[model samples]
Each structure stands twice: as structure tokens, then as C-alpha cells.
Target: MANYTDWNQALIDYFIKGTPHGTKIYLSVDEDVIERIGYHFGQSSTNVIWVNDFCIAVRIKVIFEGQVNLQHLKGRDSQGLPKGVAFLCATILAASQMAQEEKTSETNYFKRLREILALDGFARPLGMKFGNEAEEPLWREWNRWLMEDRFLPSAQRGGGAATYINYPISQSLLRRTDKDRLRKLFQEKQWQAEWDAQTLFAHVRREAGAFGIHLKDLLTENKQRHEAIVEALHQVYEQWKAQGCPTADKNNYCTWSRHLFCGLYRTEEPFLGQVDYYLYPKQQRGRSLESVEVKQGDNLHLLREERPGWYFPLEYSVSQKELDNGAKYQISSPNDLDYLILPARDFWILIPDAENPDSGAYASWQAPSLGTEFILLCKQELVSDIERLRDEHLLKSSCTPQPIFNNSGWVELQQCMVVSQAWDGVFIKNQALKDALQPSVKLLISFSGGLRVPKIGAWLVNHGPQITIFGFYSTAELKVTRLSDNQIILESSQSTNTSIRLDFSDPGHYLIEATFAGESSQRLVKIVDWDELAIEKYVHPEVMAINSEYHIFGSVIGQIF
Candidate 1:
């Protein structure tokens, strides 16, 4: 019977010789480790069994097989057995008895516990090779617990002639030996190891010349410093102040600013914790960016950071013409300077003046509802347009030609629609719907965010060509029809997205009719030859002669808009 220490060393030696690489290998027992059973197999050591998530399975096979092999090698009534064969037999029998005592279920930890004890003396290595077919499930089993260590074991498995297969563990700089305790601790700290080497061989066969070697010999490295974070924030503030800050500023992304928020960390192998930390920040759940630094010349608009993602000065766009003197505007508030507070998540858009028919009103109007109100203000210069309003929706009825102290003027207050409101902001939409809204030019005629215009892929009328189409409507459904034959191409009831793919069996000249919110429009196109570069090249005799002599290839295929 081999002692615990001897068995432990024997298993490690077996792994070094029998298994493939030092990374992490499958189940195996060397002939040497088993042959030694005759010398010291019956002795017992004080050390208990330790098993990791993966090798626990491997160790189970080794323990069970060793037990069966020992039984077969020595008879029950043998007089002179191996040195510790009797002791080994007794230990295996004890484990079998313990395993039998435990109840069986879908997840029987007791059975596993017995197996773990049977092989605890030997080291069951943890760690895995990502970027491979085998190690995916092993590393992705996040619920299982793993022990931390000083050693960084790499399984090159380069699977090449030159790839080395040596597994080595380095000495620890700081030692820690703690027994298992309840409540797993979540240690969130930065690492200070060379990551360049790990990424160096990551998915081997990376262009060797492309990546130059990097060396970091730091006597002392400081990652998280309060002074550093504050300095980085101020630097961002100064940059924002320098630029004549615009209305919107989400395009700015500073690496130093982000680094200050999250300190540096390093790891040899790709760990889930590190990956999660890096990727979590990228999921912006809201309508806009996390936060923006806005400035406008000397008049810097200061905002109070009440919460993490609350936005002020809503980043709606406006043209220079709207702000010009003697120009008109339909604004949400009386003063353009009045800041807009918005929630972190919602659908938002800047409605152009041409699309909004309600902008025809003159005076400021307010609609109150649910302890809040939505306000709409018209520019003073828009009085001329308001004066022309004779429609009942624009001006109130039953007005008499009454004279007033203020002559040559008329004042008529019209009704405005009331929408909901919350702590973030108010919502408003007018009931005065336009009979014929303009077509969407800014809003694309795309096919699921792709291909704004049709392409002729077929060479002749008999060949088939694919055409993708999409359109969006604000107030009502968008109906797209083939105008040449009045065939309805596609219909999207409401909302933004409308996608469809069409395959023309017989190609020819065609026109599409698009009716959006009662407004009608058309797009004319033709499906022609796709083989030659250009129509001119095939038609012109001079160009064809040059092409036939040279036997050259070039693309003169201009895209249709």
C-alpha cells in the first residue's frame, strides 16, 4: 500500500509521462505508478483527497480501476502479498462501503465525496484551454468553485511540430493557505502580470512579424490612485471647455477617462471575470449615451449630476436657418435656453419643422395633465403665417369684427393636445394631423438597414435578380406598390421598420408606387445586363476593339441611386 505522499508523487509522475501536455490531460495511469503497488501500496498517509471540477472525473476512474486491478492481481486467501496490498484493499473496501451508505439521486454529492476522498492525496489540476472545442464547456461551467494559485499554467497544444509541451509552475511571491469557508468572497482587484505573452500565442499562427515583443520591468506599479482619477476628469473638462462646445457631444470617447474609472488588470489565460468587467460597460440600455460633456463658448452650461445617467439639454438637432433672425420655430419651451431633463432610456427624435403641421400656430400654448404639463411655443416671426390661418382647427369660430384699443390686429387662441408627463420629462403630440405629409428622404428606403436602392444582378430579362426594399411611416402605415402594373410591393402598418426581399423572375423596366399616410410617390428603375462593365463599352466600337485586343479586366459599373 503506497502512502498518501508517495501516491501523490506517483500520480503527478504518471501525469507527466502518460498524458499529452502539462495543460490538463485526460484519465491515465502509468505502468510504473501501478507496479509500485507491490512495494508500498498498503501504507496510508495523513493527507486527505482534493479534487477540482474537471479532474475529479479523471481521478474517479483511476481510483476505481486501481481497486479492480489490485483485487485481480492478489487473491483473497493469498498468504504472502505485496508490501501494502492488504492495506490498499481495505481502504478501497472502506470507500465502497461509504459509497453504498449514500442515497442516490440526480445530483449525488455524497458519491462524489467518497470518490474525492479516495484520490485526495493526488493533485487534481484546475484551469483550461479556451479557443478550442474541448475546453468550452469546462471553462463555461461558472457555478463550480476553483482554487487560486501562484502558478500560471498554459496548455500550448499548438498542435504543430515546433510547439513545446512543457508545464511548469513558478514560485509564489506572496504565500496564502486558507481552508474552505462558507460564503464565497468576490475579490474585485487589478492584476499586474505580463498579458502580452498570453495574447502572443492566443490562437497560435498569428503573424509573427506583425506583433513586436514588449517588455515590462516594473520595480513597483500603482494601478488605482485617487489623485489619478481626479486629474483625468479635469483633463476631460478642460478639453470640453476649449472646443466651442456644440449642442451634442456623444462622439467623444477618451481612453484615459475610461481608464481612470476602471483600473488596469492582467491575466495569462482568458478569465470570465475579466471579460465580464470589460464587456458590461458596453451595454448602454438607454436612449442615448451614458453621459456627455457639453460646452458653448464662454457661456458654459453647468449641469448637476443627480444620478448616474440622467441627461440635461436634450441632444435634439436644429438647423442654422431656424435660429436666424426673422425665422420661425416651434419649440417645446418658451425659452430655447430652458434645459430638458430626460430619462436614461426611451425613443427620442428631432422632428423637423416641415414634418410638424402644428408649428403654424403663433402664441405659446400649454396643456396640463397628471400634475405636469406640455408646452409649445411659436416664434414671434411666425405671426404672418398664423394670420393666414382661416381653418377652424387653426383659429376659433364665432369671432366678430370688434374694434379694440389695440387696432389692426386680431388674437385667437387655439387648442393644443395634452400628452403624459413624468419626473424625467413631458410627452406631447398634436391632434391636427396633416392630410399629406412629405415623403421620407432623411428616413431611408432601406431593407433592414441595408441597400438604399435596387441593383440589377441579372444579365438578361429571362434571368432572376434580387431586390430588397423597406420604408418607414410616422403617423400611419406605409404602402409600397409597383406603379407600372399597380402591384402592391409591401405594406408596413406602423412604427419604423419595414423590410422585404423581392426576386424578379422576368426582368424589365419597372416603377414602384409608395403611398405613405395618404401621400403618394413613385420610383422608376430598369433591370438590364450585368455582365459587361458599362453599356457604353459594349455599344461603342472603339472601346470594344481596345478591350478585345488588351483582354483586360476593369469595373466601370456605376451604381444606380
Candidate 2:
């Protein structure tokens, strides 16, 4: 049996052989260490059958493998095994289990571990191998472990006994060792004796390099990078203060851009375009010709944050005779201009004019919903346009409205549909009811959140690329149409004047309401027939490039609007 002291020395020898450059490998093994650590392993045995950590844990199964090999701490075979210590370090590091010492930080330890482990089988071929210049006592000790199971051990197989094989302990447990304990272990003479002053300096230099710091500056008599970094920060603050102290002086104000200041300032009226208090059109264009009249208090204004090339809400005079038809704006408070808060990069404080409340506001609003029809329109008009102008999603993929239709007009590969919110709205017509029954067809409804049924009417023709029949109804039934496909059409009577095509072969989502004559329906397009190859290229372009620029753009921003 290998005594604790002999086993300790065996482990030390195994580690020392790998430290060609004399890097200290810290180990905390003592007379009572195994017993103390055994508690953590949920074992009562003081013999330490195994040691484990979060990253790598191993049990010392036996001294060696059958009769073919005896497991010495540093033992290696012709095939390879000598670099066990180095391998252990590697396993620990990859598991992020290196001890808490900054000197032995995971990165540094991992780097050193790699170098030593690489020596296993290759060292003998390199000639300056294990037995070169070996001392008598050291060899005796190593052989004792390999043979008599005193320092190392042999294996037991098929009911036979073996001894001395050292397996890795739990890397997680190793990392959990207290910082002070690790430091004390490093202070051992075995660790200090491995390196001379020069080797120590080199080690320090290597560690410094990992942090991208120069060794000379790090070890110099005076503190170097620390002071310089502090000075740089101070200079930045001084410059910012001198530049009018813009955001620093205002309350609830923060400057997101170094060149500009933005935030809410006090307002004189609640109706003032107080960005925080009022909601504005998410998008806006200049008002129409006749709609551009400004009251006595209203004047063409530019927003401080909304500048040269940016599109945002702003007052502009439509009067052809006015010289100041459009003028750049300066930052002003609510007293001067009522501002509404709209969410942007953070939040954009916008100014709203009461005289012409809708003056700078957006016109022709589209209903906000996750229904299939909306998604299809967005993919067609908005996504295509955005991709054409800029090779990116018009609406970022992160915020793209999810389609409500099961197939969702668009096909998704890895993309997942998340209905972050619930909505009640119009649905498409039912094909079964369209042909057999009356002119009006009722649609079966289904959706995630609880919603009320809505009354139906042809709200707008050609609302999107396709005509939309607005209906007042809601339901949770899985199937909407009598036909397997999710299609709904206007009852026969309502379809007479509509120029919209009712050709649909897939399922859909939307609202439908029962009427005395028949039924009214708003349709949600489930899957519009699209070239799969074209869509794939749009969704993932480099893989499949459809020959059209339109397809290219659509792929990038398929849900722009």
C-alpha cells in the first residue's frame, strides 16, 4: 500500500517532470487532506476512492490496468500516459476550474497545461526524455510506486488486486478550494524550488502578456497603466464639461450621443408634445398641401434630435409663398413646443403641435396585428423596399411582427413564432361557405389570447396589395373553414362588386361575423403560394440566390413595414 507521504511525493514527481520551464503546479495534499476532502465527495471512506470537481471528476479505480501496466503517478507506456498531470490541468481549465489565484488564472494555467501535456509520447523521441540524468533515489522512489505500490501502484483485474494509479479529481471541487488555501499551497518549498529568480520573472512576464500589459510597465517602481487609464477618463470628463455641460445640467436628461443631448425637459402644457406623456405616429411624412396650414402659434419647426437625413415628426409650412417652408429646428422645451415621447434607440422626445395635432403626424394608418394578412403585406411592400435600399431587415428580425396564420403567409425555417401579445381583428372568408351557401360566408376563428368578435363590413378595398374584408367576430376553434384550407371569402352577394381574387388553397386566420343574409369575413392569409427556392434565398441568401434583385431584398427585410 502507498502511504500518504509516498503518494504525495509520487504526485510531486509526476508534476515536476512536466515542468521543464519550472512552472509551479500547486497541490494541497497532506496527511489529513484526503480525509477532509472525502466529506465533500459524499463518501465516508478516508481512503479517497475518488476526487471530483464540476468540470472533471474521477475515481482511482485501481493501481494499473491488469498485468500489462502498473499505474505510477508519472508512469507512461510506449503508447502514451506520462503527461497525466498536464492532462489533469487541461481538463480542469477547460472546465473553468483552475484555482482562484490570479497567478494561476484559467487562461495562464490552460496555456501551461497544454505545453506540458504535449510532452507525453513526444518527449522520448525528442531525446531529452524522462530517464536522462535521473538520480538514484528519485528513480528508486518512482519504481517503488510502479512496482510495490508504495509510491505508485499496479492494477487489479478479474478479481485480482492492483495499486497506485492516480485519476483526476473533480475540477469543480478543486476550484471551490478557498483562495487562501490555494495561496498557502503555492507557498510550499516544492513549488518555490522549481523556479529561480529569472524563471520567476519570465513567468511574471508571460502572465502580464496575457492581460496585454507590458512586463516592464507592470513591474516598474511606479504604477503605470492604472494611472494612465485614470488620467484618460478624467480628461474625457473635463472636455465634456467644458462643451456647454449640455445633458449634465438638465434633470431626467441623458446624452446618448456625445455630439448631442436628449431627454425630457419641463413642459407648460399636458397637450404639449411631451414625448413622455403623449403618443405620436410611429412614422410620419410631411402633411398634404391643403393640410399644411399653420396657426398663428404654429410655425415650421425642426426637431433638435431629428436632423438633416432623419425622418421624424416636424412642422413644415405648405404655403408656396412662405420663404421658411422648411427650416432646421433647435432644441426647445414643452413651453415652446409640446413634445411626445416615442420609443427609439432609447426614447425619442418629440414635439407635437396642438393647433395642428395631426400636422406632423403620420397619415393612412395600418392596423397593428399579428394576423397573416398584415404579415404578407409587410413582407411584400415594406420588407422589399427596405432590402432594396439597405441590405437588412426593414423591421429588425427581433421586432418583426409575428404572423398569426399557421403557415403564416411566409415559411420559416429555424425562425420561431412568438405571439408576445394578443389581438382581436378581422379574418378572411371561408371557401366552403363561399361556394355552397349564401353570398356571405362566416369564418371560424382561432388565436392565442382571448378576443371579442367584431362586426364585419368592407372597410377598404386594396387595403394592402390584396383587398381586405373587415369582419366583427372571434373564436378559438382550430378549424375555421369547412374546407381543410384556411380560406374565407365574401358571401356570394358581397363578392359581386369586389375586384379581389378569392383564390386560396391554404389555411388562414382573421375574424368573421354571422349575418342574417349569410356572413361577413376578413381573411388572414395562411400560406400564399411562393417559390420555396426564392423564399429560402430571401431568408438565407448566400446559400440560394434567386436571380432577382427583388428576391434578394425581400429575403433581407421580408417584414419591413
Candidate 3:
């Protein structure tokens, strides 16, 4: 097997081009650079060789490792691993090259040659941005915070150059899963010591977010953007292996664009479900309510209430003919009687139209729907007290859900839950699970669990809803009511060959439930709001890959120098 030295030599040779030539080149790292490249790997390095004979600068790197520990370097000791060395080398090289080429900064490929030499391999760049140098203390503090839980004294002082932060090595850290091992290297304040409860909880939440990704959905989206990214990375690696670890001349090769990398981890162990609750943001936008004009310096004390139904005095025009017609009762300017007035705070989130099956719009509000009784009609004073309790983390252990208002005046109504791992397990639940075997509801089945197979069959509920299956993906499938009415079908995807019957409309809840021949019934359909569904479109493999690749290509040109 070729060693690291062989890989390193090839990388160096690719840049030098065997013949001596000076080229102007610039290099950048992480997301700190103005030009974006791809998903930020934990560690990376780049070399820009300037050849006077050619206008294009050669960008090269020996991508020792990738974002998800794919390279498996597993280096021992605290001198830093291959990733660290690569990161350092890339940083120093890019900086030095930029300093030398301060006068002429553009590096463009003219496409003078076809079938250019391929580079060994590529990984996403760390791609971090840097601000004013004055913020070293803050970087030191953040670094310290990352290393040690202890805060720096200077950090307490507050004002300084602001610095952005990213965790390139978070995946590696997660793999270890050992507190004592960390203590040997990092300080007590750093990540070395035993994980703190709060910090550990934060990590769990972040990982939970990643678990939410659906690969098949990602692939089918926007020309298979996500698939393109994975394929691009795979191609680079495969090419490198085929060349017997030859050096890569970045300038000579046709480069693939960079797409941000997403982390993926899998666990098949079933997770149980239990009743739990959480406080969630109700809405980000404030509602448009009656505008009460106040003198510039008016106390506006009553504004503190800010709740609906608070009487405010105002004067406005009314028809005198109506008054003469014996209609003397007062009509509020911003009429409240006709409105089932919600607080200006929560109105934006309360999509009163959620019940509309045809609107396609999803609710913006996010709150625990189970294990919490939401009493919207309770007294305002009591509600205020509940919100206050939730904000300070005082109600974290409470049995009842608490309410809170985020900075945006969003009403965050929260409920309580008994802590359990089950709540975080599944992506979506089937409301009509009990009747899953009856065949009325359509269930998309993939025997291998791969979901790639498009073969499908329908189940007919002789007395009830006729199940029609169409949509297929990695995690879930879509089923529609089979009928032949034009107005019945709303969404294009769910209406492939199937149609909805307007005459036999069934309300309440339905399911596109999935069940294997021998396995237990499970619901793969994720009923998300229109916005969350929109995310499905973006994260889809096709969309992410193409956009990311284009971004990466541009970033390389700008930073390769």
C-alpha cells in the first residue's frame, strides 16, 4: 500500500510540475474566505504554485482527511493529527502565497488543454472567515471555550474584535465519546474534562438535527444535488486510487465544484415513544393590529400589556347619515368584535387557514403538540406569569408546559415532558396506524429498505378509502386516494396515476403508512408544513449538489491564486 510520504511527494510534484516555473497564486481556507468552496471539512490544506509561463495558478492539496472521519487517519499523540498538519500547511501556504502575489491577484483557467492531469483526491475545505486582527483575544477565548469549559477573564470584559466560530473536528470529538481521554489533552475548561450536563445536552440536540436528513429525498431533488456532491467526492478518491497515488496538478485538471458536506450517522436500534412536550417559537413576525397614535413622549405604560382586547381610546370618522338613521351604537375603528382577536404576538403563527386541505401552505408555529394542554383563553396575567417562569429556565423540570415570548414577540408556548430517548427517534408518526393492515390506506413498500426500487402495489379498502401509492424515496413514500376527478387531485406528485374522489371525501386523518411483509407497521410519511417541506426541496440531492458544486468552482478560482 502507498504510504503518506508517497501521497505527499505526488502532491508536491503536481504543484512544481517537474519544470521550474513561477506562477502567481493565492490560497484560502475554511469558510473565512470571501469565496466559498464546499462543505467545511475539519482539516484541509492547499498550495498555489505560480508558473510565469501560464496565466492560471495551480491549486493543489493532499486532502489527508474529510469532514466525517472518512480518511480514518487515527493519528496518536497531541502534536495534532494529519488533519491538523494539513490545516496548518494550507493556512501557512495560502498566507505566504498571498503575501508574495499582493500586486497581481487574479487566477483564471483558460481551458487551453483537454483531458488535463487529475489530482489525487479532494475534500471540502475548512472554509472559515477571519475579521480584524484585534480579535485575537476573542478567538483565544472561543478556542479556550472549545478546549476548556472555563471562561477567559478577558472574555468577561466583553468588547473586542468579534470572531466567527465553527467546529471542524466535532465529528472526531463525538467518535471518542470518552471524557477521561479528553482530560489528558484538554484543560478542565477545555473539552478535556468530563462532559458537562448542559454542554452534552447541546451536542445531543445538534446531532438530532442531522438525523433528520433523508438521503433519497435529497437525491431526487433539483437534479440530484446531494447525490452529485457525494459522487464528486467519490470520483476524486477513486481517481486517486487508480493512479497509484500520483501527484495532482490542480491547474491542469478539470475541477469539480464544491458542495457543503452534511454529516450522516445511522442507528437501527428501535427507539420507544413516550409523551413529552417542549416550548417552541410560535411566530417570528409581529401581527398588524390597530395603531394607537400616541404623543411622541407619551408614557405608553399600557403598551406593556401588549395583549389583545386591551381597550384603547381613539377617534375616527363615521357616516353621519348612519347616525341620523338611528344607528347610534359605537363601532370601534379597528373592529375587534368581528375578529376572534389573538395577541398581536401569536397572530402571525396562528395560520387560521391550516384546516384548508387545498391551500398547501403549512403552519409556521412550532410547539409540542402532545402531553401539553394549551389553554389560550386563560387570564392574561396568569399567562404572563407562566411565560416568565419558562424564560429563566426555571420551569425546565416542571410538569406543565410553560409559555415564553422570544425577542421577536413570538409567543412560545411550552409544555413539559418526562425525559426519554424515544421522543427523538422517529421522523413522523401515522395517525391511522391501527387500520394499517386493512388496505384502505396506501402504503409504499420497499422490501430492502433501500427505497430505490420503484415497484409498487395498491391496497383497496372495499368499504372505505382506496389506497394509491406513487411517491418513492429513501425514508418515506406518498399515497393518494385513487379516483378520476379533476378537482379532487391537488398536489402533482401525489396525483401521478391516482386521483382524489370529491364525492367520497374523508376528513380527520389519513395515512400513507408503510409495513414490510414480516416487520411491524411504521409510518414513513412525514407531514411537514409548507416551509419545512420547502426545505425538503432544497436539501434534496439534486439541488444541493449542483448549487454547491458551482459555488465550489467559483471559490477555487478566487482563492486558488
Candidate 4:
């Protein structure tokens, strides 16, 4: 008679050869052995029947006929069988015992088998390819069971849904020792179904540590950091809401904060702390306009910064109509009233008038909820003009405006003053005065004093006929060159306040060039005859002729009155 181990090996050998369809095998053994084997076969398959207690009849069904194939183990002479075969035998035994107590469907039978295999760490050794069509559904069902059992810890929870961290419970990472301990706990029903998130996490933490797993590296630290960031952002949101939820647009503040929280939560860095909020069109006490520098692009400005990198801007712009009507800005309509989120090193807060704190219409405006350190307020009309100029390369990236001439400069004719005011406002309305001061009439241009020449260079005056230029300079040089003839009309070097004169005896264009310090500047001068003035047609009674050869400020002043 064969011993128990011999009978077990014989059964394994029979299955290894592959079960054939409609085949029956009879084995004669003791009552105890026959009863045990008969019970297991009856539970696992319907082909087993009792042919007296001493002998049993077994038949392979069509569905499971060719499923068992362990021919690779034919020549193995090892004392102990492989874990996979041991697990298969143990599964049949356990199923037999379970089936006798409670009947289950085929689907439940497969699920129970998978659970046993997974708990014993024999799933991988059994070479079960989840990619196989027959195994795909079972694998999915296994995953579903894991989720339902709360074996995975929650990473985040909100909106009646939760995301779980599955790495700690991944099947591929499970060790035999770990699986054994887990299997014991599961069989003992140590886990409670009513456990909360904290309680579940505590259990997971303890088990993970006993399993030689690093919870901190996998999930604990990340989860804790995420929670802390969410809390911090929540506080910030509350404060922002308390402040009326100021934004460049109606809903943009909340939207931007949501995006910010998401980005900050995923990162390893700490939250944004101690942000400085600045409002545009609001007077900054003791801050001078000279401290801000205008850039070429629309809404681009710079300021002196001690900590440059931390400076950022949340800028808003509005159309002329909106500004006048006091309409709120919107991010959707970029051309009308819009907002921009930009990362910058420096920025400016532009008010209507820097000298008058109360001049700005948006003076009472509040800061944005995100706490902007840089902000700008610009008219809508100017925004397009700035963009156009920038596209055309007409504006330099960085430049300082320079005054070329003083307000006191005047134009004269034959030593008689013709105009002594800004040219923009001067117009010739009196024909008598216009004909008297024609281009044919010899003219003289004079710069009396206070010529606001830039310290780096001299002013280039483009004038017609004789002209006298006077200014106070510590040390300067003046030069006049005829462009047509390339002839130097006059060149002078002086160390004190001096006067320079150039004479144009004929009608043509002359180049007036000057140098101060180490820099030089030049202008074109056009001299014309009196007949070229077109005095009769240009000189009008009602119209203010700014195109006249000679601008008479006296007439314009009279006309204004």
C-alpha cells in the first residue's frame, strides 16, 4: 500500500500529466484517505462519485480537462514539491472543506481561489499571466476586492470621492513573510469594517513596518505634506474671502487660487509665506515716480528691488470707456478690460498722477486676493498704442526721456521776435501778421537761455535762415555742417556760457550739429524764400494756420481771448 505522501505525489503526478476529457481514475486506499480525497474531489469538480468507501471514481470535465499541465515537473526528484504545486494541492483541499459548508457559484470559487493564492504569496510562482483572457476578469475582480476591503490607504478625500495610494499594497511587491502575516490577520478577522481613515492608516502603518516596508518613503511623508498644504491654502482662501475676494476679474481670483493650490500641493517646497500685496492706481506713500522705470511692452514696468526673484505681478487693464464708467475688469475679454498673471522681478503701480494722490479714479481699489507684490494700472487706449509701437520697434526696451529745448526759446525775424511760446499752440490767424512774417522775410531763430540739453549730449536744432543759439554749459562744443555741400559752417569750443550763430544767405537745407561733453547731435535746417510762404492761401480769417512759415504767438494769444 502507498503511504499518504506517496498517494499525494501520485495525485500530483496524475494532474501533471494533464487531465484528459471524459477520463476516469480509480484509487484504492484506507477509509481515512479515501474520505479525504473524495471530499476534496467532490467539492472541486462534479465528476467524482463514491464507488464504495474504499474506491472512488473521478472524471475530468470538458471545461477543466486540459487546464492542469505540469509536465515540466516530470523528472523532479526533490523531496519537497515546488510551492506552486503545494499551493495548488492546498487550494483543492481548502476548497473541498469550504464547499461542504456552503455552496458557491463558479465565479465565487475562482475569486476564493485567487484570494488564497494571493494571501499565500504563491500567485507569482504559479506563473498566472493576468494578460491571458481567461485570467483578466479574475485579476480585475481581485483588484476590486482589494479596494472594497480598504487594503489601500487614502491619499486624498474630497467631493464625496477619494483617491488611494496602491503602491504599498501592490501584489508585485508582496513578500512571502509579509503575505503569511497578512493571511493570519485576515483569517483571524483582525481588521474591523467600521474603521475610519485614521484607524485604517494606523493599521496600514503598523503592518507596513512589520513587513519591512518604509511608509514614509512611499506614502506617509507625502500625505502629511499634502494635508499641511491644503490646510494652509484653506486659511489663505478664508482670509481672501474675508477681504471681499478682490480679483482682476469676477471669478479669476478663486480660479487662480485653485490652480495655485494644486501646483503647490504636488511640489516638495513649502507654501507661499508672507506675501506682500500691492494695489495699483492706489497711492504708495513716500514712493517716488522716479523709482519706477517704464518698459517698452504694454503694462511692462520695473522697480528697484532688494529681493528681485520673489517679485511677481498680477496686472489689470481697462478700456477708456470702462475706466470712465467704473466697470470691473474681466479676464475673458482681453482687449476691453483684462488681467495678466506674470512672473517678474520688478513692477510698477501706475496712478493717474503721481503728484496728486487723489487724482486716480481707482484710488479706492483694493489689492487682489493672491497678494500681488507688483501691479500696474494703464489706460486702454495706451495699451494698443504701446503694443503697436513695440511691434514696429519704434520704442526702445529701456530709455529715459530727454528735453532738447527750453520753454523760453523764441523765433525771431531780422532781430524782431516773431514767436516766444511753444510751437504746438502757436497759429497764424491774421493775414496781415502772416504776410508780414513770410518765409521770404529774413528770419532768425534764437535760443535765449535755459536750453535743457541732456548732460550726455547737445541739442540738434533743424532751422531755416539765420539763427542764434545760446545756452549755459560748463564745457561744450558747437558745430554746424551743410549737408548738401558737406561744408562746416561753424565750429566753436567753449568752457563757459556762450552764444553760437549760423548764417544762411541762400535758400536750401543746412545741418546744425553740436557736441557736448563727449556726445554729439545734429538736425536739418530748411531755408526758403518769402514767395514760398503761400501767405495768401495759408493765411485765413477763421482758421488757425499752424502750417504758416512763421508762427505768431501774439495772434494765437489774441484769438484765445
Query: Judged by lDDT, which candidate is best?
Result: 4
TM-score of each: 0.16, 0.15, 0.17, 0.18
Give the winner by TM-score: 2 or 4.
4
Candidate 2 lDDT tens digits, 1-561: 333233333444433331211011233232122322333335454443432321122112111221111134345435333323322333334333333343433244334333333322211113212232221222323323232211111111111111111111111222223222222323331232212122233333333333322223333222212222222222223223333333322211111111111122212233653211111112111111111211223454333222211223334221211111211123243232222222121111122221122344321121122221211112222333323222321122323533322342321111111122111121112211111111111331212111112111111222212332322233221212322343444443332212234333332232232232333222232232223113223343433345543233533633222
lDDT of 3 at 60: 28
Q: What number of backbone clashes does candidate 4 have, counting pairs of residues 3 or more apart or in separate chains? A: 1
Worst 10 residues of 2 by lDDT: 156-165
For all candidates in order, the CA lDDT equals 0.24, 0.25, 0.23, 0.29
Clashes in model 4: which pairs?
A: 440-530
Give the top-scoring candidate (TM-score).
Answer: 4
Model 1 pairs whose backbones collide: 1-40, 1-41, 1-42, 1-43, 1-84, 2-40, 2-41, 42-84, 49-120, 50-120
Give RMSD to native, each candidate.
Answer: 32.2, 30.8, 30.0, 37.3
Per-residue alpha-carbon lDDT of model 4 for 25-120, expressed as tens digits? 111122222333444434554444321321211111001232422333222236543212222233343333233223334333444444433323
Q: Runs in model 1 with CA error above 4 Å? A: 1-444, 447-498, 519-521, 530-561
- What is the clash count for each candidate, in the order shown? 10, 56, 42, 1
What's the C-alpha lDDT at position 511 in model 2? 27
Return whichever of 3 and 4 wins on lDDT.
Answer: 4
For residues 1-561, what per-residue lDDT tens digits would candidate 1 score against the true structure? 234334433333332331111011211111212333222333353232222212332333334533322222222123221222222322222222232232312123223333543533222212211233222222211101010110112222223421211111000010011000000110111111111111111211122232222100000111111112222223333222223222222212111111111111111123432210000011111112223333332333333332222222212222222222212112222231222211111111111111122333111111111111122223333333333332313322223332111332322222322111111221122111110011112122321221112222213433422222323344335454443476765665444333444544333444433446444333333444444334443543222223333522242432222
| Candidate 3 structure quality by residue, lDDT tens digits, 1-561 | 223333323222222221111111111122111111111111142332212101111122222232112122223224221222222223223322333222312121101111011222222232211332222233332322221211111111112321121111110111111211222222222332112122222222233333212222222222212212222223233223333333332212222211111111111122542212111111101122333222212222111111111222212221222211212122233332111111111111111111221332222222112111222211223444444434533223234432322222222232232121122222212211111101111222221111111111111122222333322122333333222232322323333224233222322112233333322222111122222212223332222224433423422422222
RMSD of 4: 37.3
